[model samples]
Target: MSKDTSRVRLTAGRVEAFTCPAGKAQAFLWDTEAPSLLLRATPTGRKTYAFESRLNGATVRISIGTASDWSLDTARKRAAELKQLIDRGEDPRELEKAKASHKAAAKAAATAHALTVGDLWPDYLETGKPKRRDAWKPRYLEDLKRMSAPGGEPKKRGKGTTRPGPIYPLLALALVDISEDALKEWHDNEARASKHQAARALMMFRGFLRWCATKPKYRGLVDNEAGRAPAILENLPSMKRRTDALEAAQVAGWWAGVEQLNNRTASVYLRALLLTGARREEMAGLKWADVDFQWRKLTIADKVEATRTIPLTPYMAQLLATLPRVNEWVFASTKTLSMAVYNAKRRERDATQAGRTAPAGEVSTVSESGRMSDPRSQHAKALLSAGIEGLTIHGLRRSFSLLGEAAGAPAGAIAQVMGHKPSATAEGYRPRSVDALRPFLTQIEAHVLALAGVQFDAQVEPGKLRVISAQ
Candidate 1:
């Protein structure tokens, strides 16, 4: 019953009676029956069975089990085995440690075999970074999530409620089920509703499979090329690149209609798209610092490269000059304007009246992810207003290139302005100075404006700037 007792022989009754010393963190009592056996107690009086002995002239101790779990006889038997190890000059503690580790590894290997694609997906999304950029683009990341999204709530587009993510069917599947036959069936089933979307989703799923093959835990599970099965590839839709662009005669009217857009930022944004020939996102991320009226240049975020610079023409400058500096963007919409579009305020009000707190960190409806939402509806309206139609946003880029070509601007010059790969040798020879590139950009702007009949001299913008979805 005491730490130094001549070893009262260990019995169920004596074991139950042992208690930890009041001031010490742990207390132990050695059993006379098995000198190597110990009864250890924590300050809280909980006790466990353990064995202590010496090997290679050093004391080695190994825990057995709690008194509640191990009978005295069982503990004595374990002590005898440990004493044999000690007699052989082997550390029992080391052997105990190795045994525990081996058991753990065996359990882990079994669990790893059972891990599924769904199990690894969350980690993949968290650690995944795009090749072209530092992080995944919001919409693209969303597409990754969406293609594999679970089904529950009624969706915005469909009739009989929501469809499960295109990847959902494979989510619950075990890694062993990821075979060419499996992927082929999933593709064909998905292609029935929309071939293009299914094809795109398949591409993403394939990427996931490849990533899994690279991971040690999943390396054996995926075939890697399971997604590239000829059946799945052959089943995908034949996609043709879209060739939409603005016609020359539609410029003036399109420009006027976009100018008339009520939301000032959207107006400038639409006009900027046509004027700069920058991609939609490139224009959306335009920063005030990147725009320099003194030098007459606009450095835009470019997907191909990191960033690209193009001349800021007179009309484009005028359009920007009139815009409100809300945040960092040269063009930003008011929260009121954003809420009005998404009816976020109404939804928030409705949510408030229902005694529900807003969903935490819910995205603002105004900027569809820090940039203007799809301009299709409003753009279509503008086209209608101008008595024109069929001009996609990118069509403006095409329009700029074609218009520049017709106006005698060199292809390389226009290509450089549009942030193309610059295939023409003339592009390499084009002057690097902003002053050198100025005339080509100016002429292109002049031609587009003349066609659009939007003539204006550059005006001094107020020294203030605003922050918008320059995300």
Candidate 2:
């Protein structure tokens, strides 16, 4: 049949027969049935179906598929669709690109929806910082990790695998699926085990969700209000304010119990807490550099500021001066059996590696972070010995405030020494200098000593602990 050289009625036989000219790199045969439909052939016998059209005065070429994949009828129909798009003032290439982009976005959304709290926990822990602080405190950071930790690992101190943390179950849930219903159920389950711990875990998890809301990639997936749902809030246990502290009458017995303790450092540390009204952690974190023997002042790490300087009374100075200078810490824990064993193993390893005996007296003098930790049990023992009940280590701090007032010290002086933030009040809102606080502190210490029926000369040299009476 007569036909144009480059165009012809395409058929199964003609399609198979298409091939590039020997000298040409490629050739095309346009379908007469569909103007833009054509079969392209390379010299190597590779073939494909393609559509070509012009839009905005530029040619748009799109590969339909290979000859094996696109049937003659199917490729022609696709070519017809492309022509209709071009007629409607739409570029087929642009429409195809838009479809591809939409498909990719949908896929990304699906991926985000499948993300679990566990997936982003590491990133959150690394980047999430508390308000008013540059980074998480070491202790609070440890709490975060412990709250989310999976169970089945051996306990650090006791036998048996540790229980999963309160926040552990929620880690497996998809971020988007952490709805109010999900959280309510989670809180209900965890509260059954420990309401306070569950409440703490919920608080921590909410911080994580708030962090997620700040991130562009995770913002859409997290529901910040889910953690604050009324259902969860209603189930939370009522928080009770602690008012437990030593009464004036309990001082003598408590002092006697604390004095008889085997741990000399702890006995003095407990007394220091009562004498100075310092927080448990703040006093435990004291370093030698923070103490000023010459100035009779102590620079303690403050909750309200970077550090606070308080008058170091004669009694408190005597207590601290007697503590062993074992390390940098004023209340350093004694080296335990575990520490000795580990050090011995390490020394043996070093000797084996070097082919000689290790140096003498290489030992770790403290098991934990050089500072004293968890004196509650020891305090409990002393309380038991004294027949006192419900008095916490923090109770001693509260005791100081009450005793200091009974000593007739000004409210502001007591608050300043205890590192309390000053409030607007007639009682004394202004801060006090170290010298201004010294006499009041000394008065409070003398009052406490008399109430406990203990008499010791304040003029005695440091490192001397002499109690003439404990009646």
Candidate 3:
């Protein structure tokens, strides 16, 4: 052992040297008593802290922290700790390793504590909401509401029940708090009630966690939890293929049944779904502005990317011409119209009683003119009344796709009309223009209308059907 130069205070620009038979190295202790107090300098100018001291027939060494952060007090304190451990018959080297591990764990826990599921949800909404046209679809929003609270009770939005939104319950826990076991429990319980729904929830939750991992606050906590969660769906359940497509033979009978529907607006809405291959919500929420009569086109902002433009087949055009425009909505309600008229009447009476002249035509029976009805409740009631079995509003869009395919429309053209992403091969190519797609869309619309026995100008010449609309 080298003699201690107690008179000299270890400082920057000062180094102390010692030699042992084991190796010849110089210990450069920084001026401060910082954790990174010493550095071993080689004759070749390579510097490291590889110094060791033997205590009770065992070797012990300390790593003064890096030069940048070490202070004189910190280094001296660490050196004393190591010395005391050595004195107590503990291996200082083992003690150093244990201290390092505890520090690392504490640092990780601090980072985990800083992040919570609530913090990540807004980001998920900002990035993911664009994927949906109406971010709050009734069913999807309803699910979100259930997951927000502990018991899945519906929240009150003013006087009405708030719709559920996305984000599952387990996913809403703090990222650090979520463990593989918790996720497994949630998945198993959800699966018991509805396997397909559980599968969907897992997928959505996984996406949320993935977003969490990329954020600085939750980075380390998110990845491992998400990675460890078991795959909820080993395989998606197979759907039973239904041959529910309307046959040419059934066209006349279906039309007769549809015409007898008591709710004229619902009948028109269903026919529009079949005629234009528009999704039910798109047609139900159809506004007058979306219809371009001059261009013979109906433009719809779709759920996915881009707006879908379908040609207005002659039959569909004729149907539109006959309908009364009640409001901005294409299918406004009679009750709402009556309510508007009643309000106008009250206002007119107050004006007359106050000796003030009323504006002409302000109190007309057509007060709520040009608006449309909410198709959902009405459509359901109509379906029940018509005895239309195994049919849904969305089913019309699917039927349209199938019938279009059978009638020989290209898959890409059908997908574009249906607002689906183009297939990989098609995506590689330039997107087809509305004009380029017009002819195929016209054929599809004609085919669908024909399925409902609504004739158009295009004649389905036997061989021409194959050539004109090749699927």
Candidate 4:
């Protein structure tokens, strides 16, 4: 019989010797051992191992590899495996695709397994935000950064390196390893030093886990509720609602002590907190643009809303006019310590200079934020001088609520001026326009001033300073 040259057994030598005809675009040589297997060559001498077969009345050609990468015998064995899939009435192309998909899934799983919380924390901070907010507020964002900070740098106020943040330890943990048991252990360890700080950190971390769960790539890797596991919640410190406001009688002393403060700006800030019942930060963030002396109104940054306008009482307008327009801030920061405080610190440094010489440069009391930052230390000094114990900065806010009621102002009006969320039980709970809120605010201010024994003259020209006298 004549040699059947169309079907020849493939060999490394025969495959190498094969070439496409000069005028033809391509040529093929079929292996007798695996009839579906073929070595294909192009006119430019490119060659490859491929499996070609009929499946469901259509021809399917699958490229296995290049001629150099696969030996003749290995190519034949792979082709035989593909043919088996076709014989079983399955598409070899589909089988090859399934294998590729499984390989890709395994690779992705490996990559996910290697991911740590530290790797994704920055991304979370950048995109994650509280409900109804466009982005994290600057204060809250700083809190988040502090919670996860790796602290080895020198303290801002003292001698030693700062401690690592409460959440820093968890950053090294792999996302897949975050479990109820893991979080419970971390919470227990952190709660040892400061229960409230640890609890706050846990709350913030839960926000992180919630954000991660929303991502497709990180979905299955973390359990969003792990931070809130019952084991962890049970150990949280009992939350105590602070009731530390100035008593009606204590207001006279607080006012006197505040007026005696050496830092005039701090004295004004502390008094402003009491008079307006604004949160410390909200008051500190005040700008000159937000004050409207001509309209006898002040626009305050509200905690519950974008902004709230309240009538600027006579005393407050006069009080504001006394403040120098140092910068944009209604209460601008001086960024320097009072002469007495600075002298005391200098004396202490001189006393300790024998061991190690202090750095010889100006000591900045606080970073210049263009607005007043923490007045707590000065507030504490004021409290101590007044012989009033347990009164907090927020206590001033509570005091305003208590005193406003004592002054017979409606609950809704008090709530509105204080930037509190209105409730159904508050009288006239509906939102009142700034003008309608005027009489109530002025009434509250008058009552507070009377209690503090402050006498003020409101007869000055608009935008001019009105004199206030303390009895």
TM-score per prediction, in order, is 0.55, 0.71, 0.58, 0.75
Question: What does the lDDT read for residue 435 in candidate 1?
Answer: 68
* Candidate 4 lDDT tens digits, 298-379: 8888766788888888878877777756557778766533432465477668868776655544333343336767899989
Judge candidate 1 against the unseen true structure and give its global Cα lDDT, from 0 to 1.
0.75
Candidate 2 lDDT tens digits, 227-275: 9999889888887789998899999999999998987778888999999
State, as a TM-score between 0 and 1, how close model 2 is to the true structure: 0.71
Question: Per-residue CA lDDT of candidate 1, range 1-471, in tens?
Answer: 344434678888988988876777777888898999998888877899988877666667788999989999999999999898888878876777899999999898778767777987887787766555587766677788988888776765446667788888888887878889988888898888888888998888888887787787788777898888877777667776767777787787787787677766777788778766788878877877898977778898876567888877776776676664445556554553565445656777889999998554432434332445456677877889988766788887877778888878877777777777645435464535566667888888778877876544344453232322110
The model with the greatest TM-score is 4
Overall lDDT per candidate, in order of appearance: 0.75, 0.86, 0.59, 0.83
Lowest lDDT block of 10, candidate 3: 462-471
Sort by TM-score, best first.
4, 2, 3, 1
Better of 2 and 3 by TM-score: 2
Off by over 4 Å in 1: 1-115, 118-172, 184-197, 210-225, 228-238, 260-264, 287-289, 326-328, 334-371, 421-431, 457-471
Please give the range of 10 consecutive residues that has the lowest summed lDDT in model 4. 360-369
Candidate order by lDDT, decreasing, is 2, 4, 1, 3
Superposed by TM-score, candidate 2 places the C-alpha of residue 218 at a distance from the truth, in angstroms, of 3.3
Quick one: how many clashes does candidate 2 have?
0
For candidate 2, which ten residues in a row score worst on lDDT?
361-370
